[model samples]
Target chain A: MDIVIVVADAVRASVGPLGAAYALTAIGLNLHYGYTGLLNFGHVAFLMVGAYGTAVTVDQGGPFWLGILVGVIAAILLGLLFGLPTLRLRVDYLAIVTIAGGEVLRTVIRSGDKDSLTGGVFGITQFATTFFGANPFPEGEYGWGRLAFTERQLWVAVVAWSLVALATILLVLLVRSPWGRVLRSIREDEDAARSLGKNVFAYKLQSLVTGGVIAAFAGMIIAIERQSVHPDTYLPAGTFLAYAVLILGGTASRLGPVLGAVVYWFLFEFTDGFLRGAISAGWIPGASSRRPTSARSE
Target chain B: MPADAVFAAEAVTGSRKPDAILVVNGMHRSFGGLAAVDVGHLEVQRGVITALIGPNGAGKTTLFNLLTGFDRPDGGSSTFDGRPVTGLPPHRIARAGMIRTFQLTKALAKMSVLDNMMLAAPHQRGERIVYAPLRSAWRHQERDVEERAGSLLEKFGLADLRDDYAATLSGGQRKLLEMARVLMAEPKMVLLDEPMAGVNPALVESLLHHVRELRDEGLTVLFVEHDMDVVMGISDWVVCMGEGRVISEGRRRSWPPTKR
Candidate 1:
């Protein structure tokens, strides 16, 4: 039997793109939850639209840039559609509607009827040519010792992390401005801000659109990195993870989300690695350590 | 001499146009079975200090709310500067040049005193996103706002508290700050509800000076005050309300003045 020790560092390196994707999504969550105080549980719906928009565009022979544009437009449109009716409703209603809306989008895309376009349970594959073609890096593997990545993976990491940094800077500058003060004021007390001549609903809509666009950009990057698309990639679990990252980082602070993203991914990697090692070493009583266990285990 | 003669002469000579700066006609409001206000035909003339006085539960506050667009009336209409203003939102009504202060001094507590004034300024081009970042254009406007706020604060002896949070101010200072914030908007008329309700005597004198100064500066002033001495000393015209309707209307000195 071959013994392959995939420690925390190794696991992190292997799943580097996934962590980056989550980090980007979490940044968007920070904008919604932290700054604006919106409880958006359907953020994953925007992610799904970005992923499917990009995938379907590429599958239909559209250029990668065009796919990215369509994904962004889809995200903005979805944000407006979600925000128009719900933002004016009470906060609790918005939360319920958003969570339900996300679940509906996920189930619809994964349904059997949409299999031809969305690839149903099988998912879509071979959708990365346009993305890889635009890679600025030379075609080769990159990184050191335990953190090696193929040329394509390196490109994805560069794009994903760069987008995260740029978005964070933009958000910091924006939230620091007078406009941002009105937003924070609205978060504190909507009626007070309204009395100050601020259009509260308009500010809420702007926040939703901006945050959704950032999340969709992250989703596009994720689809490009995986070279495929799957409906399961955008689940309630993903939204929950982003929210965890946001809270851990600190809500409404500019660099909190980025810091949160790094800490969350590292912690997740460490816990998963330690659990796997403990289970294999027969330190926990879950599956039998003997060979030829159930086929479901495999 | 009849106080009505003085009021009539002042009304005609000041600006006799039938359209008062603010006119409340047959205004009535009810909260369930309770009638909070039932004012009929109140006119606030331009460039004069008119005081609305009544005992507690006389609907003075409700009348202020209806005039300022904070609450809707169950019946009748309000017109400001000849335009119907009955249904406009409070902010819109404020932007239309009629500003008001609350009895409780509704300052934005979390914001700095200076910020409260800036937010109160009318026609803020910088509120829009495209124009918010324009430093060059807004710098002049921002400076003017700051200067006006600073002058008003200085005039009210609050110059040193510019950077302080409004919530940190004393109750009297909050009342003064609320008055200063309304002045920042350059309103054509001001509706001050209980401007001196809880203010200290020293600040009350300052507030009276400012109210007189507002009239001197050609801004119409209508304030609800229970202090008969203060109302009679500064008010050119007085309208007394009781049980949600006007009981008497006359000049301040001749209306069987009530002692505080």
Candidate 2:
């Protein structure tokens, strides 16, 4: 393969659907860790629930909007389940519960016992046709040169970027407002916030639920973009990637996650393609040339 | 004369004041085998600065913690503003018109000074998640809150640093900020834990003045302090505590309690 074409393909995919999904996940993580100081290690659980919720709903012939609604609600419920018992006690409990919840969700979805509803190991597919059919971006290619995308991809891009904008705007407003100030106070010292008449536990639960719902939206978007939902789609590694995105973007800064997702995805796609190309050319034959990212797409 | 040198010549007896806003009866708290607070009866006068002075490990801080609902007492029943507040959560107690400042000055380090003040105001419609997105839903309230916060900051001599981060504030400034921030809640009663700790010599007079002003403004002030100068300079009534017991409750000149 021509090196230019390989690099071009990487560039094209970087800013497309993958970057948008990662942006959503990191934004949610920023709220959990940066603002509220919740040590949620199972961020992927929200995504898994979102994907499965939407997927199962649509597969059962539910409306696409209803599927999205179900996805968001499931995420909120999952957030409560993870937060209620842990938030009142200590930070360590949250970390343990979240990680456990994520693994349990993956196991349950992949198990044969719930094959009919969850589709088990084979997963669910064709849930995105209706989602894409609602798009109104017109029939044309978008983006320039190496980053060009077809009309279908452009539709997802428009919606994804819009959601990104909306989430960021809301975050900017919330963080600067009275509510945001209370959140920062809690992050600084929970006892102080409580002493100031702010219900620390309730505020923490709100933050977790909001973050989880955002992650859920990211999940549904990615699932629809890919037109399928696999049990392995939300592995623990996915949570780490979101953290990478968050760290790349400075914590507690507006547009941090968005900018971080953009830069990180480009580098990720570029390096993955470069390594695969070098291996195919027999340049790095002694080492394994396989990339772990392909397992995600398949 | 220095504000710390000014003395109040008021007099009051044990568990009896002209206007008692807080009454603690049969209150008891213990940590493991050690009792932290064991006051059989105590009454804090309304609209007066009452200082709880004790040496280290006297459970002064523990009493403040238990009264403010920061810690669960083994056994206790207290009333604030004629309502039973014992066993209520800290936030609930605050909402019921009582607020507190920490001993170490929890000033929300990363936030701006103005944001710290705004955090104390309750029932803000803009704080709701859905309404937060709409500027119109809370723009006027936000402005009002900022204005009130700005005035309090000005009163505390921190108006110049409104936009600055709380973490950058010195120990004295943080104490001032924490004190000024509580005023935004419009609390009827203020519980101050070691407010004079880590304060600068220059700012000490101003803090004393503010403590007196709280009483003048019809708000009750109960402060814990180890500084005798502060206790003497401002307290209308002093509740001297030692080893988890009220050694004496007396005024400035009437101190050196004969009961102990």
Best by DockQ: 2
Let me know the TM-score candidate 1 reaches against the reference structure.
0.82
Cα lDDT for residue A145, candidate 2: 72
Q: Pairs clashing in candidate 2?
A: none
Give DockQ: model 1: 0.31
Docking class of 1: acceptable
Cα error, candidate 1, residue B136 (Å)? 5.1
| DockQ by candidate, in order | 0.31, 0.71
Worst window of 10 by summed lDDT in candidate 1 chain A: A289-298
Q: Candidate 1 residues A1-298, lDDT tens each? A: 1123345363554357766677778878887877677889899888889988888888878887788888999999989988999997768877888889888888877885544778787777778796778888898767665567778888888878888888887777666556666666666556555555566788888888888999998788777777778887887877888888888888887777777777777776565555556677887887655443321121
lDDT of 1 by residue, B1-260 (tens): 21233455322212232336787788999888888788767777677788888899889989888877778899999899988999887767777788877777677776778877776666655565566555565667767877887887888788899899888999999888888878887788888888998888988888898888888888888899888899888888877888788766666655664322
Off by over 4 Å in 1: A1-23, A39-41, A86-90, A107-112, A116-126, A282-298, B1-6, B9-19, B52-65, B103-106, B133-140, B153-159, B164-167, B196-202, B225-250, B256-260
Q: What is the lDDT of residue B254 in candidate 1?
A: 58
Docking class of 2: medium
lDDT of 2: 0.85
lDDT for position B24 in model 1: 79
